[model samples]
Target chain A: MKPVEIIDIDVSYGAKKILEAITFHADAGEILGIIGPNGSGKTTLLKAMSRVVARDSGEIRLDSRNLDTLGYRELARQVAVVPQDISIGFDYTVRDIVMMGRHPYIGRLASETLRDVEICDHAMHLTNVAHLTGMSIHDISGGERQRVLIARALAQEPKILLLDEATSNLDVSHQVEILNIIRDLTGKITVVSVFHDLNLAAYYCDRLLLLKDRKVYATGTPEEVLTYENIREIFQMETLVKPHPLTGRPYILPVYTHQSGVGTNRRVHVVCGGGTGSDILQLLHAAGFTVTCGILNVLDTDYGTAMHLGLPCVAEPPFHGITPESLSGLRECLDDADAIVVTAMPIGRGNLDNLRVLLDYRTKPIILYSRNSNSPMEDYTGGEAAAVLADLETRGALRVEEAEELLARLSQGYSGRS
Target chain B: MRRTAFITIPALACTLLVSVACAAALGPTGISPGSLLSLPNAWTIIWDVRLPRVIAAALVGCALAVAGTAMQGLFRNPMADPHIIGTSSGGALGATIAIVLFAGAGRPVFAFAGAMAATFAVYFISRKRGKIPVETLLLSGIALSTLLAALLSFLMYTAGRSLHQIMFWLMGGLWNVSWDDVIVALPILVGCAGIYLFARDVNILSLSEEDATHLGVNVEGLKRILLVLSALVAGIAVAVAGSIGFIGLITPHVMRLIVGPDHRLLFPAAALAGAILLVWSDTLTRTFTNDMPVGIITACFGAPFFIYLLRSRMKT
Candidate 1:
């Protein structure tokens, strides 16, 4: 049996519904993450699984047993939850708090035995709160208090552990520390956690249950569930989704673009390559420019950014020279353009026609863009590309550093014509 | 809990024992230690008057203090007490009903029934989806207490000859405590013992109801059981001692400061300390204040202590 199997559960508070038709299951030794925006019922879903908030019409099963049939202590032996944070009302020592997790095991008449003490000690050691056993809970730091709470959950020795944004309040390093501790327990204990940080969830969770507006929007691997379109649609914002360099998991970088709306139907054809053109492409796109980019290899990062933004672009396959067909596509983009902009990407023989083609557009306003002046342009074409660049510059190809200055000059050109 | 609990529980027990002996010896009748052996009918005075009063005061104090600690821990608010939540008022109304209608027959039974009914009323009124928030709990208690007080005022207005007795009982004291009244208070130990069984559950519960449930505590059930037990204990204390006020409020706060907030240690420590506190308050009133109501003395100190708690709670 799966560790937790929730089928078509609907939860509501009075007249307000929280979750509807939620169906999912967590397997044995799997770490599942529930991720969503604020008020998306991420925490409410966790509460439903733990039986805190009663479900309206659904069944929750643990280890093949119906959840309704199990007693409170019996269910606690199988599932433990670590809250986001708790404000302890009393001055209890750390040991006293941890030992309370053993409440389900000890009978009403029996106090904790030596074995219970050993289990608590081992739990504290696992979460690194053993040294704070004698300290009052109020005296500990916020991060340390989170670890102690995790230790208390561990002391329950539950088969399934649930967390509700348990590390959301901690700093980056502390978040990493607590997530690493939780990740180490996977494959021995089944873990289901709600995460506010997408990157951490991508790295830590084996599977993700993406929620949107109290519904299961998607559920799959992080790579599948945390897609560009999915995140953009669910969160109503643009984000760049790429594989993490170290862990090979999906890493989401939010695209913070403000709609400048100043392009004003003036088409600007950009000749750029490598990853150098990705930022300007987004900035120019967000500024409402009718932008066209050209002649980049299919494998180029700039091509990916251009495609993500739905900008029309001329492209070639990887490891191939720019063909006559692509040259015509580039010529058409230049012919229809009000101005031409080129980022300071490296020049090579494979794509040297881009610079040579730029020399032909002398009548059009050609602005050579460089985000930083120190790294102008690298020529791997034996000074031939530099010669072409000098000829273009002599013919009034204005060079501008910084994307803001380039935007100002381009918008000024648009206004100057009117 | 184990470190100081070993010395603290025993030390408190011994202190209660010593305080009871001292309270019995010093009263308004003047039974000094030196003249006790030579005085005529000294044994009769101790047997018929002093011993029962002192023992009843100690038991009632233990009952009130233990109830207060449980209520504070259950509600997760240190300011919660039996008096603050209308348990004593319910019992006072019950006792007043007995005096006015039945000439004080079956007063303890009436007191207990009224206390339970009032507790359940406040509990149901404050509860929302099986959880009682601190704000609503306190507000409902105040609401019910005001209603009960209005009912009580109307009863006293029509009481006629019983108004004097009702007012005296309303301002709780230990003036006419006897061995029969002591029998009525003896079941308080049974009630306190019942509360002690859930000490560990109360510890987890004090953290937060959700956290307690994650650790396998039956939160709703635990609350119901603890509330019933507290009402029972506080109800009986009212029946015997006539609604003693802040022995419940002040004792738990002081014992929590001394023994920490672990309910296992806190329950016993506060019980002994409460018994000691009320015994002394009663003795001082009888010996020096010309037999004034002990509730007046307790309220005099307890009200200021409550204000200090409120001020410090705001600062924190």
Candidate 2:
């Protein structure tokens, strides 16, 4: 059964509608992440669930019971909320702060029971703050304070826990550590947290609810909700979404659009293979050149980089020699180019056709990047590929050893042309 | 800290006992312990005058100190006190009005009513939506207190013949208090007991109202109850002693430094410390000059200590 259900909730403050018709349910024993841009009412929605802020219209049910009808103590016993930030006025000890979470259970004229102390101790241990019990709250770092607050919430021992940007103040490693702790909390208590970092949410949350324009934009697993198109629409920003190498979950890299150079209108065709052209492609792309890379094997790392960058590419099947069809595709990419960049990839019999294709494009403005001397011994084609490269250089191709000089020479050529 | 409390409570009790004995002995006509046992006149002087005054001073001190602690916790501000929040000024104004009009019995009733009115007004004015923000509460208290002080000055200026009596009472001395004055302290004791019962809730409330509410405290209800109780205690103390200053403000803070911010220990400790402070201040006044008001002695010492605290707080 769902432990928390919010249905058709509308929240407004002084006629400002912060959230409208918000509806979702947290499944038992799952981590649900609420994600949205600033002012999308993610924190407001969490506060409404915690009853810190009242909803204008709607029903919130905890374990099929109406939230409004539950007494404050009863609600606290079932759900605990870790606020975004707290500024304590006095020097309360860490243990003092955490033990306050047991306020709902302890009665007047009664001290903390042995069981209450045990729960508090277990919470402190879980948050890795057991040793800081005697320390003042002001003496700790921001990350440690956040853990203490989470420990305070854990001391409540509720069936559901709500966090409102609990890790926002933490550094990257602490962010991961806190999220991992919360991730472990799932299956024991349903965890619902509002996250500012999409990657951390994607990594930790079992399901995500995306808020946009004060409403539920989408809700699903990370793979479904964190699509590039959805992010582009909701956040109004361009990003590349790919599977994380370690976790295979969706990871987002914001595409940097701050382009500056003379190549805004220029197109460059990169002739590279075996990952040699990957750096050149990125440099040229970042320099605002409309770049096309050709004759890379379909499964080559450079080919994958090009695909990830959303650049047009000419490709062949993995482990296959260059064919007439691929060479023809490279010739077409070479045809529309203002310049050509040939990276210093080792030539073998399998890619000897790439050299032949470059020879055909000798009349185009070509820049060759070779960090080593153009020696025949570097060729596996019995000097045939080197001879072709020499012929292409004699045909007025510029030779450069670095991508920076390549970009400089291209900008110079483009300026001269203009 | 527990060891400190264990040592401090009994130590303060012993100090209070010695101070009360010394205060009961050092009146205008000094009563030696031997003479008090032998002479009937010395016994009459001790019983009829000094004994009631000392008991009244202790009760009034305990009431004001406990009220101050509660006010500080309720407002979540260390600087909060009964005097600064206009409760004392309101009581003083009520007593001055009674002296100018009905003279004798109207003072306590009017003073209590006025103090309750001022406290509720501050509470109501500071409230926004459903919660009382600390900044607004403090600002409203200062504003209302200033206004009440102005009204009090106007009353003092208008009093033609009873002005001397009004001034002496406003200066705050326990010299004229009788056993009937001590009888008025019973309700203040009950109010303080009510405040102590909700001490845990007050601790949670001091953190933040939102936190207290989430932790199952009916924050609004608790605030209302504590505010009324604090006002009742402050009003009774002011009615009986005529606006004794600084015992409410300094005692709780000094006790907090000794025992920490936990109100369970701070409350009782502050009560004992306050009783000791006022009993000694009254004793010092009596020993120095028979006519000197106890409020003058307290303010002379308290004002400097208050400045020192403010300066030290600024350094931090």
Candidate 3:
């Protein structure tokens, strides 16, 4: 059993103080999750525990030994730290890199022993990177590289493992795969990981430490530390907490904005593609207009941007063609709207029904661009579409040249153009 | 891997042998390659004249490449060139003072002294604000190199009759290399390589000073050893080969691209590659037309590749 303790430790990079008077302790055979926003000193605290980052004032102790007093090899044997940014920038093969973890175990004149090879091989197999042992590090995908890094640490055979935001760049499935591995290793090895995802921490970590403004805000079991009030205070985001369906741990649903002052009047449905609604949604929301978007995919950079902007955007899985269910969802969002604005995102086969829906909503003012007809969907521009759009333009539908013009026209406090 | 290693080792050996043969065959009066192998005077000339020059070139090449590779690893930057930290110019200034002011008396000793002094100065300056900032290393290197280059030029302008000899030395020629020059330069080169070869302890040192110390590496001591070794090798090399360029910078870089950035592999690969590249460069300088300074041939080929790499990195 290993005991890790941080006693009022403070850390600073140059003049900028990153962590302040942080005190915590982890019992043997426990998993500790540190959760915070970007640049919030979560990684810094882990580094300090691993003795990778020097603490300015307080002492970090491991198994009753002062951290600073231990030699590198001694520390390497006890605490294996997977750094937040593991950049294998060269052409070393996966196996070769994993063997670097054995650096502390071998003597100067001696080659790697059979036991070292066995440890590394076991780590590779456990991490599921044995198939990629011969591949150069530069040639592997980011997810595969993350596994290799974890394998390297495992090869060290440390009693305590420190991972700093180790799964941030991975996809959801890979993230779950890594978290499960960390979970399975918990009783065998003490695990500490800096995490940004509260749900993941709640799922895997027995205890959670929340950092705020470079100080430890709270620390306890996941249910205690990951509450709505604590998360609202630490992350500066209001959230609704409920039991997770599977694990029954507290799951947080973000409460974006209070609707009291913001108008619920003049609700508008947006047909957004290629990130076009980002500005329009923001501008409309600022003008007290309620807006919802559809025909966007989750993996698009735009979806994240829209989520950041707190828009109720309907998203499909990436590369999956827009289904009838999504089209129906878009129609339902449009049914309540007084008007619609079509931003000049490229239209294609996946989203031609959005433009067709616009044609059916003849009373709604349709704004098209001159250069916007270059969509990949022929239905959007070919056939009798040109003449139909021309008739619509002459009758009531308007055409705008710029995004700013579209926003200004939409937010004139009323839908009078139609 | 064994095949590559065998092929490379023999190729280096063959190149060294051929360079010695060619340099021996051509002199004040031409001696053919076959005739030199047979005659006793030609054999002595070969040993006394061409052998030392060839050995000097190979040793200096290995030394400069090892130093350059170590510096690049320390910096974690691929674009780092030899003399980016001003060691070469400092060594040049030292050699110039020894040649022009001291009149080639105690030249190698004084050059080594100047080189060490310049290195310490650069180190102290880089470490001043408690961190060895990469920008500080690069900028200060440029500043010191320019300053030393100006001082060297001043020494050149004031050297009344010895200006021509100093200029030729500065331009890097192996024409006048002798057994004594070989004896003086080879030990320093070999010693530096040996010390660097024992630098597995330093392999764990981070690209940054702070990280290295935290990793339990004696950062100050390692930096001092590295800078001193680089200067010793460079000072001896400049003392022998004048200011031969590119082998120090290019050989290390090419080696890094082939073997990973791990210093254990990088250092030795650089030394071997440098030995091969310079021996061939000297051979080219000998056979291409006139017995030109090997520096001219290296820079002509290496500069374009360097520029192309820089542009490509920028594009990426």
Model 3, span A140-249: residue lDDT tens = 88888888888888888888888888897889999999878777787889998888888888888989888888998899999899876687767787565768878799
lDDT of 2 by residue, B1-316 (tens): 3448777888999999998898999967877778877787897778888888898898888888998899888887776778767788788777777767776566777887788889888878987876566568768988987787778777767866466556564668887878888888668878888899988888788888888877888887888888778878888888888777778889988888788777778888988898999898988888787757888988898878777866776797
TM-score of each: 0.97, 0.91, 0.73
lDDT of each: 0.89, 0.84, 0.72
Which portions of model 2 miss their true places by more than 4 Å?
A: A273-283, A316-326, A344-355, A370-387, A401-403, A414-418, B97-109, B120-140, B159-161, B168-170
Candidate order by decreasing TM-score: 1, 2, 3
lDDT of 3: 0.72
Interface RMSD of each: 0.8, 1.3, 3.9
Cα-based RMSD of the predictions, in order?
1.8, 3.2, 12.5
lDDT of 3 by residue, B188-223 (tens): 656565656545544555334443443345556766
With a 3 Å backbone cut-off (N, CA, C), the pairs that clash in candidate 3 are none
Winning model by TM-score = 1
| Better candidate by TM-score, 1 or 2 | 1
Model 1 chain B worst lDDT run, 10 consecutive residues: B161-170
Q: State the lDDT at B9 in candidate 2.
A: 81
